[model samples]
Structures are given as structure tokens and as C-alpha cells.
Target: MKNQSPIIEVAELFTISENPNLRIFDGRTGPNAKEEYLKKHLENSVFVDLNSDLAEIDNPKNGGRHPLPKFEDFIKTLGSLGIDKDSHVVIYDDKNGANAAARFWWMLRAVGQTNVQVLNGGLQFAENQNYPLSSGEDSYPETDYISGHQDWQLPQIWMDDVKLATQDSGSVIVDVRESQRYDGITELIDLIAGHIPNAKNFPFIDNLDDDGLFKSPELLKNLYSELFENYDQNKITFHCGSGVTACHSLLALDYAGFDIPNLYVGSWSEWSRNEV
Candidate 1:
């Protein structure tokens, strides 16, 4: 089957609600994410917890707060979610796909799942569009999802690599946290403040518009093309707090038809703890 766009609109999802291969997920994160999901979510959507499902959390100094789970564990997770190779998966979160939604999308794409997509504009947009919603959990029969790749196919960089990239004039390291957090003015999440030595600040929220929807592909392409004009795609890396929001920018890049760049999953959480 031909791959679909990484972004899907509410109207299209509504039309395809009855597709037997469709599997919708609510990928929200926060202290009360599950509670919020249990209260209401897209109809027939199963809830996926960020800390438990998408990540293998341990010491922050080790691999940041939300490191990717082991590949085998993630495969089992996919199976438990009823996501087979052919499943048309759609994910959303309340944060306009900036939270765990994009992380889930990236993981699926990394595993060579071409039919997965993130719901454009996320839950609020769906609710505003009057897409059907349901309270409580929805269940589905599990499938043993067979992966095509032995590991993540997408580019990922560790702290040591990122450290080198920061000093390489040919490379660009982008920090996707808010400017204040990047500037060392304020930090509510990670223990430390400020950004990597030479990492450029490009908050992930900039990927959205006034309606909280992603900007036009042409516009995004133009915007990123200008910013990254001097560097090769392979030389660019993106990171954010705990490695979650960085995928939002990566998603934007993919939506803009650019090659997905390297992801620094340790991000600020691990960097701050390890570095000065």
C-alpha cells in the first residue's frame, strides 16, 4: 500500500471511521493524561501513556526522562494496541500533536509503519468538528505485529554525537524548547536552564498557526529551507525537553517534504544533568 501523508485532517478521519483497519490512539501525556483520556476521546480510540508505553524511564542522567523503550518491548506494545503491519493508525493529543502524539508517530514511522499518521490540530479540533467521542476505554483484539526492521530506521543521535555536532560548523543542532527555556531565563521542567553551546532555538510551537493547526507545507518548507540552507540534512539534529517535542519539528519537516533529521532523544533533561 502507498504511504499516506504524516498529517491527517479531522474530516478525513471522520469519513474513514469505519475502516476496519483503522486504529485510533489518544497519545496524551501529563499527570492526569489517562484521566483526561478516560473522560473523553475520539470514538473507539485507545489511550497510550507516554511514560509507560512510548518510553523507558530511568535515571534522568542516563537516557533522559523519556527514552525509547527496547525494540522488542515496543513491538509487543504495538501488538497489544492491535497495530499490525497493515493497520492505518491515527494518533492525537490535546496539545496539538506536540506532546506524546508526535513521539508515537515517530516511533511508528521509525519501525517502518507507513500507514500511521498524526491527527492534524489534535483533539480540540476533532471536538470542534463534532467528530464522535466516547468516554472510558475501548478495546481491540491483539495482533502480533511483525516488524520489517530490526531497529529504528530513523536517524537518532546520542549526547556524545550531539556534543560533536554542536561544535561542527557544517552541522546545525536545533533546540525546540521555548525561547525562555533556551535563554536560561526560566525553566519549570528540567532542573537546569539554558541550551547547548551552539544549538539554535526553534520552539516547536512555531510549527502551528493561529488555529493551532500546522502551517501550509509550502510555507513550512520555505521557512525551514531558509534556516537550514547552509547545512546538509544529515548534519542537522533536533532536540527538546525529554526528547518529546523535538519530534514535532521533525514531523513538520517531514510534512514539508524534507528528509527527517537526527533526533537527540536525551535532549535537555539528560544534557543538563550530565553537563555543567
Candidate 2:
């Protein structure tokens, strides 16, 4: 399959809405996500639940609130979604691309799929552009997706590795959460308020422009370069609450044409609980 750009515009999507190879997915999550999706979502877009489909969520205390689904299970999930190696997947969520949309993109990329992209500016942007929306569910033919690997090809670190990195001068743990949460001032999601020890806060919002679209590649490249100048790419690790939004920055790094760094998928959610 040919590689597509990591970002896709609303106009571009509208033009190819009927492409046989195009598979659209909505990755919105929350208590009301299903209800909202059923009420109205992009026409012909299949809804993928983050809590059940993308993550295992067996033990939040250990794996964080949204741990990645097992490799085999994920492959099966993709099969159910009609995804194959040749499919061109477009994903989006309500929170621009900062939510599970980027995570889905990262997951597809990790599995070596080349034809996946996140909808730039997400659902809101599409709505503003007058893209058609549909109520209720949609369906597509299923596929027989097969996994050739046992693990994610992407760089990821566990809590133990993060602990080692905290003490290692050559390594840096980067926290991509907001400043208040990082400072132990205000936290609404994870149980603890403080961030991981020795991890530097670099909020993921900085990846976007004032309009909520990602900034220019050059600007993102320079910004991340300065943040990671002292450490090698392999030594640098990125994380956020429950391992979700961390993919937002990872997506930015890849879009900025830099080598993707280690993702601490457990992130603050697992770290805070285990450390406490």
C-alpha cells in the first residue's frame, strides 16, 4: 500500500467520500460519545470505542486507564472494522485530533500500515465545512486481517524503564499534559495531581496553532529539537495521562519528519498510582 499523509483535510475527504478504498472511522470517547455518535457522525463513518476496542482496560492501576489492546486482539478488531493492508483509513474525534484520533493513527502506523491518516481539525472542522452527517449506525464488509508480528513496531517504554530514565542523566521523560496538572495544581482526569518525577512538562496543545490545526512542520521540528536537544531520540520518552494524548505529540514528531521517540504508554495514570 502507498503511504498517505498523516493529516487529511475536510475538502480532500469530501472529494473522495465515495472511494471504495476509503474507510472512515470515528474515535470519539466519553460517557455521551456513543449517544452523540448515534445522533450524528460523519456519513458512512464506523464508530470505534476507545475503551473497549482500542484498549484492554483490565487493570487501570497497572496498565493505566486505557492500555492498548493486545496485538492479536487489535488485529481482530481491525478485521471487524473491514481494515486490510490496502485500506486507506481516515480517523477523527470530537477533540480535534488530540484525542483518540491521533492514538488510532499511531496504532495503525505501529502495525506498519501505510495508508492511514487522521482528519485534520477533526469533526468540528468537517461540520464547519458543511460535510454531510448521518444519524445511527453504518456498516461495511469485514475483512480477514492477519497479524505478522507479536508486538507493536513502535518505540514504547514501560513504567520500569521510565523509572530508570528518571535517574539517568542521558535520558529524559517528557510529560505532554497541561501545565497545571504537571505542577500538581489542577488535575481532573487522573487520580493524582502531580506529574512523574523528573519528567518535564511540554503540553500537547503547543503542537497546534490558534485555529486548532497543527502548526507548520518546520516550527514543530524546531520546537521539539530544542526540547530534545540534549538527549538522543532513543533516550527520550513521551507520556501523558493514560497513554492517550501522548500519541498527539508523537503524531506531531512524525509529522515534523523526526524519528518517533519512546512512548511510555502507562504514562502518568499508571505512574501516579504505582508510585503512590
Candidate 3:
């Protein structure tokens, strides 16, 4: 495995919790996320809200339901969490790394913070491994985080870019939603079911094993290699229902020693609303 792999095992995380530079974030998302955090979480793990901390929920149509937050606001958020450029951030969510945990990791990396990793197997896996859990909230002393970039460093495309890609044979748009959702057989979350035209279905769940943990790096490399054949990694775009789970695929790609592709942050939610 690569030394800079974006994943860290639960045992490794437990051992590093005592390090002064270590910062753990609980990235659980959804309606009852806050309440769940108040109930139980990893010791010393500060809760990071997906909607507020990680996203700007001004309008769903404008930038999907959970669009990336403003750059300055995110920098402040990092500061509030006592995270600087050198901080070692380890984020985890209840739903393995497939939920907001991966999104948080992506957001941190977008800001050029290199010392971040998503907890492999997430909170559930930690519990299975008998890792200790603590109840109630936690807080950390604020620090200064002076970000250099006004925007994300990683690749991301909007709906217009995706539309143009549909007509371009060189670009490959990947829809990371489930098969049922991709085939228009079911439209539960979004208003519509079918995927964007010319987009290939490579469900994000496929990146995980039956144990709900991500597959081995070698396995992921081979799997994505087969899926992407001759497609240029740079020309590839990844998206999920609203761009949350899409990060899971992106993380898997990075862990597999592949280049990180572009993300359509608005994803299906924004796409379904548009006439295109």
C-alpha cells in the first residue's frame, strides 16, 4: 500500500489519537446526524456538520443540496477545529467512508492540506473492532488556518461542463449511483431516475467489499483500470445523487494509485432540475 494512502485502519487511528497534531472528525450526515453524535462518538472526535461545515446549502438548484462551502468560511472552519496546514486530520462517518467522511477528505485535499485521511471502515468498523466510544460533545482550541487558494485545487465541473462532455468522445462522465437509480427504474432521492446521457454507471458501492469496507488498493486499481480502459483519467468526471457519495469513488481512485478525476458537485440533484 502507498505510504500516503488516504485510508487509515481503525487500529492505526486508535494508536495515533494521543498525538498532539492529530485531529479526528465525526462526519456523520443526514437528519438525525447531530443527535447521533450527541449520543455517542469516538473520544476526542469533534463533530463536523456536513451541511454547515462542509457545504453551502443556499439553494439546491444553484449548487445541489450540499454544495462546497465558501473558501474563506471553510478556512475559518478549519481554524475553529484547530486544524492548520500541518494538522493530521482523520475523518470518519457511520456509513463507512461512503458518506460525508469521504467528502470531508476531498474538501481538505482540495485546500492542499495533505495530511488528511478517511478512517477505513468508519465508525461502524471501529465498533466491530471494539474501539472505544465516548458519549457527549467535544471541543478543541481554535488555531489559525491561512489557506492560499480561493477555490478548490482538485478538478470539478459544473452542469455545463457535463453537457459538453456528453458530446465529446474524449470525456467520460461516470455516474456513481446504484444501478436501479441509474437505469431510471427507481427515483427515490432525486426527482428523476435516469442518468445523464453518455454517462457510464459505476456504482460507488462497488468500491467496497461485502464487509462494508473499501476493497484492497490492488483490487481497486485493477477494477478501475478495467472500467476506465483507454479513458483519460483527467477527462473523467464522477458524480452521485447530490455529489456526496461521489467522493467515495474519488477516494477509492486515489487510494488505488490513480489520478483523482473531476467531480460534478451538483450531480443528479442539480442535473434533474435543469432542462438539459
The TM-score values for the models, in the order shown, are: 0.98, 0.97, 0.97
Off by over 4 Å in 1: none
lDDT of each: 0.93, 0.90, 0.91
Select the stronger candidate by lDDT from 2 and 3.
3
Between candidates 1 and 2, the one scoring higher on lDDT is: 1
Best by TM-score: 1
| Candidates ranked, most accurate by lDDT first | 1, 3, 2
Task: Write the residue-wise lDDT of candidate 3 on 30-139 in tens digits.
Answer: 89998999999988899999888999887778888788888889999999988998789999999889989999999999998988999999998998888888989987
Tens digits of lDDT, candidate 2, 20-104: 9999999998899989999999999999988888889977788899999999899999999999988889999998788899899
Question: Where in model 3 is the C-alpha error above 4 Å?
Answer: 1-3
Task: Kindly state the number of residue pairs that clash in model 2.
Answer: 0
Which of the numbered candidates is closest to the native, going by highest lDDT?
1
1-276 per-residue lDDT for model 1 (tens digits): 435689999999988999999999999888988898899999999999899999999999999999999999999999999999889999999999998999999999999899989999999999999999999999778999999789999999999998898779999999999999999999999998999989999899989999999999999998898889889888999999999999999999999988899999999999999986
Tell me the lDDT of model 3 at 56.
Answer: 89
In model 3, the Cα lDDT at residue 250 comes to 97
